[model samples]
Target: MNKPDPIPARLAALKTTPTHDLKKQWRDLFDSEPPPFNRRYLESRLAYRIQELTYGGLKRETVRRLERLGEELDGGDRKKSRVRADRDRPTTGTRLLREWQGVEQVVTVTADGFEWQGRPYRSLSAIARAITGTRWNGWVFFGLKNHRRGA
Candidate 1:
């Protein structure tokens, strides 16, 4: 008789596990403190960790291929991407719409920054300035938080 597969059982158990236990498992498996995120995030990461420990991680070729794909969008510049992440900028093709005073404002996200009224803006603050004629926190004006979700 073949031995029963334990991975499925292990994965199933994660759904019912307490958040604290999941955090501990994350610490044990990752050897680091669990990030401050919601329970869903913890469960998913823990599930991946369990599977990774059982079946080895992705092959080097797959990792390299993914990196190349990311480079196509990130321009292979780690520093610039890191800064963009800090700013919590939206991805390309995102449209931000807001109504101020009596006019509807529209901003389209681009790799460099944003475009509004056929003008390229280096920052959201610039767009906000053009719309309101006053200094404002661009993210706040655009109804977005300064930080992204704990992704």
Candidate 2:
């Protein structure tokens, strides 16, 4: 006869199920990609931190630990990309959109880009479309260069 592991109990107790739909939240935050990004905005705005990583993103070791813990907890869906590290650059204008439906928004993404607001909108039109759908009244565009605030 042995005592039960307190670690399990503590983890179980700490396992707070994500309250807000991650998809929607992720979508909303997705609008802001590239650089000068702040994932914290989304977490603070939503009042929750569904993603396990930290404000500065997760360290490799932490990710592994989390994955291991998750597996032990019967949650083993965390998969790591096998692609090479050097090929992570944005070679073209192609923007990758990662949608999380829970928050009702889109994550306009690119290998080289910047984040504005919590959502990672690539262009004004995309943002407009997000807020007003395809038929809404407005237009948006991104110039090839960055303009100064006064200009």
- TM-score of every model? 0.57, 0.22
Instruction: Give model 1 RMSD, 1 decimal.
Output: 12.8
Local accuracy by lDDT, each model: 0.83, 0.41
Worst 10 residues of 1 by lDDT: 142-151
Mark the regions of model 2 whose C-alpha exceeds 4 Å error after superposition.
17-83, 91-105, 108-151
> What's the residue-level lDDT of 125 in candidate 2?
47
Model 2 lDDT tens row, 1-151? 9976554443343335253443355556555432333333334433333333224457899999987987875445433221321143233444434333444333334443423345454344445455546643222133312232213
Q: Model 1, 64-144: lDDT tens per residue? A: 999998899788898988886756777798999999998889999877668888766767887898788999888889988
